[model samples]
Target: MKQLTLAGAIAAVCGTTFSSTAVLAQPSAQAADQSEIMELIVTGSRSPERLDEVTASVTVVDAEALQQDLQLTAELQNILSFRVPGLAPTTNSTSNFGQTLRGRTTLVMIDGVPQSTPLRNGALDVRTIDPAALQRVEVVKGATSIYGNGAAGGIINYITRQAGEDAFNVSLTQQVGMNAEETDDTASFRSSATIDGTVERFSYVFNATVDDNGVQRDAEGDIIGQALYGLSGVRTQSLFAKLGYQIDDDKSLSFTANYYDAEQVDRLIDVTSSINDGTKTYAVKPAPGQTFPGEPQGVDGNSNFVLQYRDAQLLSNTSLTVDAYTQEIENVFFYSTTFADPAAGFSGGNSVIVSEKEGLRLNLESVFDLSGVEATFIYGADVLNDVTSQPLADVRSWVPEMDMSNEALYLQSKFVIDDWVLKAGVRDESVDIDVPDYTTLRMCGANNVCRGGNPVEGGKLSYSDTTYNAGVRYNFSTAFSPFVSYSQGFDVSDLGLLLRAASVPDLDQVQTEASVIDHYELGVAGRYRALNYEFAIYESESELGTATVENPPGSGLYVPVRAPQEIEGWELALGLTVNESLELGTTYTYVEGQDPDTGAYIDARKIAPPKFTAWADYTVGNGLSASLQWMKVMNRNRFAPVDPVTGRYTGAEAPVEGYDVFNLSALYSRDNWRVSLGFENLFNEAYFPARAQAFTYAGYNTMGLGRTVKAGLTVEF
Candidate 1:
């Protein structure tokens, strides 16, 4: 059987041959109305290809879906939890703890620019950018080495908005909402404005947004604490701009800059009672000090700058692109008196971590015709430097400055013949890290318990690896396309954490080895009549699985644990358009992992229980639309019970109960104006998410939000 190229697959599915340029240039929201079968170009892939053409399992969330009344949220995690089947549930907090993709850490990017700080794993990358500034999100589900290190699980690329063909376009949106149970200080406000246009051979886009949230409340109408790094009572602002100039029909240059800032206002301290009998309760009161009960606790800042040049016709059949970028990030944690260590020069103060990165990327794509076969060749190289460090608010070093440099070269080729498509790629990656010796900080105070740090050794380390992938996909028919693929990825251990806790006298004596993960997958996707569906099963394995574990027992310090492990999972999604005004959809996901040697669920921290989501959308006459969504999480009993006092798991394992929630949204549009209303937790159910029940001691047991109402309006000109 002959396989079809992605373009041919799209033509088969849609019964039309779409212009690649036209499809790629159209906005996702507008494109959705033009075709029943989505044919958006995949951005995560180095080469131009449609979603169905690739042999990997991929999902695309378009602009319309992102702006849906029920899907809009300040936190990106919440949006992904419901849309991406394999992704773990959101923690409902500012921090994205335990939120893994395919049961592994995922690499996040913006327009092909890396956003993850792999050296520290701060888990803050997802919130670095506001969703309002993005036009679409592309998710590549599986291990891939084409983009270099840190993509062991997959990659998420956020494509920013672009200038329209109009001479000038302006848009403004405003939203205001409050907790239905307690409307006092629980109100929130958000607003965004954008201006974009294309004039002659130049194009430009600029957007700005601001948001302020009041205290969050549970079903009981109690103020939610700042525990678990909650997002309540926070203020955020963002600015984004892009400018492009066309030198000719085949050549262009562009520049982009973005900035984001967020800070938590501490209005009340968390006085939540400890977990008892597998249950925990939360309460809040004014702080003892004169400082605002909601003084700033967590402060985050992110800035990015990029310059790019592209030539679509560098030669007769070749194209080239070059990009240079720089990124700066700063994260500050809340001040803590209870956890303060006087010995560590801490008198109830906070800590801050900063990371800076600069990189240059180059790529050349070429097409060739061999006899009757067509092939596309993509080759690229990357060079990057990153420096990261952690320091106390008082200017004392916690983690010494670490400098890292990475260099990589990769090539990928896609072949098409008849209705068959085949792809193969390989990457060579090299990394170097340098650390300077410094005295460890004293962490214990006279009255407080402290975890001591390791003092000796500073040296340099180097690592290199070659990873590859291959896949085959057969079109068969647009209604029944199936594919299989195998790929590998490599990840270096969190060097900053390892170096900070190093006790060895010499850096060379330390055991630091990169872990290589292998992924295998089989999937099929199709569209028949008014229905579209996809199903996939995959297995990922690593001889040495990496996990963070408490070290020195009771020291309150953590170190990485490596063991043989394997993870397997499956995902399914189905959508049906009953008519022009009605649509229905559902998604199911299940995953499990274990350590072979220990015979234990080693990925308990990352794995999510089986989940099912269903939704219905109905459009009424007079430009009104309504939607209802339901999500149910199944029970999971993987970990043994834990002693509350010792914070250690007991021998007895107990099952974590399941829960369900419902949401409703309505939108009305007329002329150039749109109004929307959304109700979350429509039933006002008082249930705990899986994370809260499983990790009770970690403050994950915080009660879910009660019924909340959001209303917004948008104007376009």
Candidate 2:
């Protein structure tokens, strides 16, 4: 029952994000009247419910906090990195390669529409939408069956911004940034426009953001590489629009669309360096006769559309909601020698993943009595179609096209008896996938050893499961509530990882079976006057799970391996509001996972190291406010630093050295104008992030970004 509202999830909660305290710390009368900001839960039950009553762990980053986040960085990965606990840090590139939620893939969504392509898992879902277009973000913790497939960890939903009560409103923002380590050719720019209005029964909101980035450098003033997991010289643009129509007091309809694109423009080649040599890779301009190869690496495009209709009084006390959605996305990866075949006519190769999804959801909620105890029942049916594939651009097929159809029906019951609240839900899901006969592209590692490119007979695959969830909460007093929960999640877990590396003669011989995760959680929440707190512990396990492993050791050919795995973690959050305009908060998080059969701790690629985060914000009534945030990742020594035989730093076995970072932001607003200034990586700490150290790859050991500054101005009319 850690159903703390985004505004109340405070810093004191370990999994609570920084924005938890920010919403309540706003310069508003909310500090005096706590009830004014009581947020309604949406993603928790797939319906609007009271935050304090939801029987699950959820985190929300409200609008005010999202605004504060934008002032600091434009990257969505960076926004979620320090804000959400349990989630791994950003790779600081176009890819979310190592970021995970509780050591598993989290289904990223926009308005209940899935964005993750688990079939191929390009790890680009995190950046599909811009914060400027969203009103808030909701995170549901632990395994879940709410939104079927790829939710082994949980879900992150980005709620679109809304039209305010104002009859008409418009806001424009422009900002520029540069690396503090060195400024030459390092200036970045961003601009956004938002318009919203309400007219009688109609309301609409539109937002657009354009971002142009420049060369990025580490604390040592070396240009960050562009070969892999690099962010330098990229351009990103986001467009979002939402229109709502109220047919009557009891019925409404809405349509939403969002499109995002990012691509590398600047020409910079990576100067590969070895982890064994204790050297960092850096980017450099090409020489006079040198030229780039392959296609520019980044997101080619991502588009999403959703249409929703609701009736508050469809029949008697029953309510109904229907949703329709469509999505398409393509993620392009960097050119690498990992897919090269020296004996063939290939030098090096790059690949891209294309996914298209269409789905429909129908839900109904009814109120009734269950044996004299007040109860509510929610029932829903979902149908989805997804087609995904991965292929080397203009070359050959890697992962053949997989057409999938999914159908699910679920029912949830909630009972309220005096001071006790109990809830349970069950979902029956069926999935069918068809793959055509194809040949796995031949690939060569750095050692010039060839593998794959064999013809595999394809056929139809079917999966079905019944997932269940139950939880109970006891509200003893206004200050304390504790809850226990159990849930299950089903996922196919990167099917393409298996298909592309297929040495099997046929699809039947492959381990294409789905994975089911069992999740358990116990948590408590308390609020005392101006202070709020939350604490939770969780465990997730699977009989057949998947993880990225460097096959054959030191081959640089990473593959997903199926194994029995278990993950456990705990979190705590605390927030204190001093008077009406000052707030202080902090959180601590720890997570770990292992293979039950081998009894060995998982690699850092999946599990995040322990973390500590703190923040302080103050509002000066005179149109000025400032906030400072800090984070520290603890040392992760799960594996040895070097290989026993080669004396080389083993991939994914390199020891991870921890580091700390700080950020500062200040904003001033008067009349119709607002100005903001922010600093990232305050004090310019020169260090490698957890993933960079643990990855132990030639070009992936890049350093974290150096100190950076951003200044922006906004005008309203």
lDDT of 2 by residue, 381-472 (tens): 99999999988886578889999999999988888788777788888999999999998888777667688778999999999999988767
lDDT of 1 by residue, 85-132 (tens): 787776677776677888888888888888887887777777778888
Given candidate 1, what's the lDDT at residue 552?
Answer: 56
lDDT for predicted candidate 1 compared with the true structure: 0.73
Deviation in Å, model 2, residue 408 alpha carbon: 0.6
Model 2, residue 198: distance off in Å is 0.9
Q: What local lDDT score does residue 486 receive in model 1, on the 0 to 100 scale?
A: 71
The number of clashing residue pairs in model 1 is: 16
Query: How far in Å is the alpha carbon of 606 misplaced in model 2?
Result: 1.1
| TM-score for each candidate, following the candidate numbering | 0.92, 0.93
Please identify model 1 stretches exceeding 4 Å from their true place. 1-38, 69-72, 273-277, 281-283, 287-289, 292-295, 337-339, 343-345, 445-453, 552-554, 642-655
TM-score of 2: 0.93
Give the alpha-carbon lDDT of every model: 0.73, 0.81
